[model samples]
Target: MADDGLITIGALARACGLTASALRFYDDCGLLVPVRVDGATGYRYYSEAQVDRGVMIRRLRGIGVPLEAVAEIVDGDGARAERLLDAHVAELAERARAAAVVTRMIKEEIRAGAVLSAAALAAAIEQVRSAAALDREMPILAGVLVESSADSVTVTATDRYRLSTRAMVPVRPSGAAWSVVVDAGELGGIGSWLRGLDEVSVWSADDALILAGGGTERRCGVIDEAYPDYRAMLAGLAPVRTRVVVARDALLAALEDRGAAPIVFLADESGLLLSRDGSACIAATITGPRTELAFSPTTLRPALVSAIGPEIMLDIASADAPVVVRSATDGDLTTLVMPTAIMNSKENDA
Candidate 1:
């Protein structure tokens, strides 16, 4: 008995620094099973060799590995098990990086003694409302574009391939007019704090957009430059003959899980082709009569995903022209993306 390789469930649990119930729970979850069971007494016993495996299972589970995956690794080859752990490690690293960025931003805000203003809060909410599909890396350029009689505050951002545009209600301030740009991240952070407010006030001074209301004042820098003429870019496209209504969430889920690009919109009779350097040809379905234009996946997908409505309305010009995607409910926010081309011939010229 002293030399036996087996240990009682209680003893094993103590060795693993876990309770007996936890060990049983792990067995119930298929992560670990006792090596032998007493036929009549229904006693459970685990081999001493299983202690290390049990500890590892507990550690992996604590870190959020699914029970099924943990079982696969516990029973599979060492290399495959290591590969699984490595993938989890990489994911954790990404989460850590994102957390660090947020932590730093919070510390900065606290150090500056900044508070949110009514106008700034409203502008921030409007920014999210207008372009919810804008990429995080894309610069969120928001500011008041003031002219002689009217003042228009606009929020714009582009992932270089696709662009989004949103504008706030025009307000005529009784003073000289000028434009100021603000950082989108800072706006988003302050906006998060000032949720539930109906109106927010903002002022521009010392190259910063200041939000002052609710006894808190926060200052964020404004973006520089006149936002690109997105409106002009979207004008004069040929009418779209073919229109499709698709569920926004379904399409977005498919794209995120499978890396499937957005649906291609083509117009007129021109053929729109898709190909990668080492990938097979991608053919787009023809939903309506032929026309002359096409739109890029980069621009179309983000716009579609950002839409808050249940469905999206896709409209395209000819195969070579810009394609427009609009939220079924809000036509004011439109995304126009140019078509991409494939170069078939290989040539060398000095």
Candidate 2:
């Protein structure tokens, strides 16, 4: 120590296991002030008492604490500093989750085969998992139809009332086209298996369908029976003349509150009217001539739940055809609903 009872910046830095430049920068930033400065030599010095402060500063920075935050702690408000640290910890945790998901998104090309997005596979599984059979009439409807082509793997499912389809891209197509229907009931807990993976490969054997991703493999029984021509149904959809757009959440809220009667959509000059029985329950704007179509909200809510975006557009195809619901922001997700025999408010009273 100098005769003035002050230690030179060099000595202080050595004692604190830090560099003199770091101390100088900290001093300039007002985080740690020097005890003394030589006017002619322009050298900085610290008192022996500042050893603890210097050690704290070095250790805090070593742990990734920002300088501004260190200054707050040095100024005598440790509680506020703790709060800031807690916030940082929370941010790191969220990033970890997102990173895990992204890491699983990397497509690992199949050996002598193509690559597929495992995350997208997981999403497709989720969309169609609930489309299994309601009764025992058609056992084939209880499975999910998955087909892979040159660039995509498409998953489709339907329970007669609604059909859900999702396409995953980056799939290396096979020279020979192949399709299979896997029991969707086996899809339970599949999402958990793909939480941290980036890519997956799919294959099939005599009676089983397999999905391998994130170092995990899952297999389920396949339905040998021919799946209904879902593609034909979608392709043959009738043209539409009226379209009503409503935000998904808003439409869901109105439909969910439909007392006891089936949900009805009445579209005229006064806008679209959503009703439970004969009376109007929720009012929304419609973009075409007078048209009212009724169907069970209980039956229709599932499609709305599956639809994406700030608003869902309802495409009315004549009076007897199915209505298509799609995301307004992006047309990626679509839900098709078959209209009920009941299409007017006057039929409810009788």
Candidate 3:
């Protein structure tokens, strides 16, 4: 020891099991600056009491905390620092969970191999799509909503949260109008079949939607009742009265940063309100505000994340009603989101 209350930088590094260069880096970062520097020899010294904090800094950095975050942790109140750490840990956990699900799906697909029938594959695709939306508690449902006409065949699924409709026209098409509701699992099988071939033939028989593709056939049950009057819903929507040009990624990032789900819609005021824990609120600017209606960040964020568009157009009736979001690039895609009433603007002052 150099003195009763001090140690040379080298001694401190050895005691903390950190390289000298790492210590210097920490000092440079203001994370663990030495207490004194000798003017003559340029030697550095640290207080013995810094050993615990040094160890903590090393451990935090080992776990991949950025230098700036490490500085915040070191200087901030214990509770706030702990909250940041916990949030990061939670994010890691969510990512791990998502990875595990994908891994399991890949493994299952491998096990099934080419032996899996086309119908089975289509069904699998449908299920995965449903799982992605359902996991988020979005009310809209997805299925092989089949409609057969003399000219073409249409299969569609919409969450209303964010509408995505995919259609395939069979080459040797069945020219009949048929409506069916296939479970996600069954739709996955149909999706699998659809993938194997450029076209598929589908028919409804005995309450099942039968899809035949690449010589493999799959069948799924029809939904009991007609789908909600989706056409009527669309008709009820007011025309686009206001247009706001926003950078899709910037707005999306901001919403994600605030943990709000993105919803696309026209609002009376172009503004975003983020509500957390069901009460705390944060307000953000909507690129255009006067003509369009306002939307909750919670609803808009998810839609933005799911949107595959360079620009989104929102159509709204008023600030208090459901808003429709249409993709500028894709005319077929639409998203409908009900706005949460804003009783007081002060709630979202942040």
Candidate 4:
């Protein structure tokens, strides 16, 4: 509307889909200052070239981005802007997860109690217990997740690097589904006590897990924390490129010999080879193409030792992808072991 082809503040506001007053506020904040200001009437005007910038600022603010973040995103280079946006998104996700946990804690109700074999439940708990994280910042990962339904009870735990889960058929299934996360240290002690009992009846109420059996009852406080979406990670795994079935004890012994060093696994039609500078070979029933992967002995040995059967099966998607480990004869327990790196990276560096 200005004579020199500069648009008035009102026109720029309409073009950018923002109110005149909003534009004035941004101008005052030095975010979208107008191109010109009339000395006589104190009127603000913007150049046509500034319209795109105004629109971008409006869009950035629309997403609830704080002005400081918005300034970083709008005024910084592409990579810096991307990093800022990603950080903002991660913060939002964390906040949302916390909110969801609080809401569930307030509104959730436990419908029925579950009856399960005490020995089997205890074993399941021990199998996955080692996967719980010890991070002070993430107290949620310090607990094990237990979910019960009409048919089965499943326990799962993860320390970000690996995850283990076991599903057991209940002696008497709950009439309704329920879930709770109990601290791993407390659960381990409870499991030890439960091992002596024949059966245990468990239920959740008021954010606590109560187990009753043999004329004795014990209660453990449930963690009011948000757990990571491990199911999504499991479901999103790529198709297995190689599969191998090998003796669990033999593999466990080989890993034990490796001590704390990293181990590389090389699998082919002939068999599977385990190596850490020195090498040991185990006969295996292998399918698919030859594949090689590496893992920390500490990270993988527990998974083999905790398996229920004599033989363990591994499903590998890639050298770097998470390897699925389960018992060949009894698949009730499953573990995902994340590879440290490909063999080439280790051998070449060494």
Provide TM-scores for the models.
0.45, 0.62, 0.48, 0.66
What is the Å distance of residue 199 in model 1 from its true position? Answer: 1.6
List, residue by residue over 237-336, the lDDT tens digit for candidate 1.
6877665555676555544432433333222223222222212222233457754333345455556766546766667655565556667776645565
**What tens-digit string does per-residue lDDT give for candidate 3 at 106-225?**
753432212223343353344224422444243225453656555554445556554434344344444345566565545443443376675454567657766555667666766565
Candidate 1: regions farther than 4 A off: 1-152, 170-178, 236-241, 260-288, 291-299, 342-350
Error of 4 at 127 (Å): 0.5
lDDT, residue 198, model 3: 54
Local distance difference test, each candidate? 0.57, 0.75, 0.58, 0.86
Q: Which candidate is the best by TM-score?
A: 4
What is the C-alpha local distance difference test score of candidate 4?
A: 0.86
Itemize residue pairs with steric clashes in candidate 4: none
- Ordered from best to worst TM-score, the candidate numbers read 4, 2, 3, 1
lDDT of 2: 0.75
* Higher-TM-score candidate of 1 and 4: 4
Q: Which stretches of candidate 4 lie over 4 Å from their true place?
A: 1-111, 276-278, 343-350
How displaced is residue 124 in candidate 4, in Å?
0.4
112: Cα error in model 4, Å: 0.4
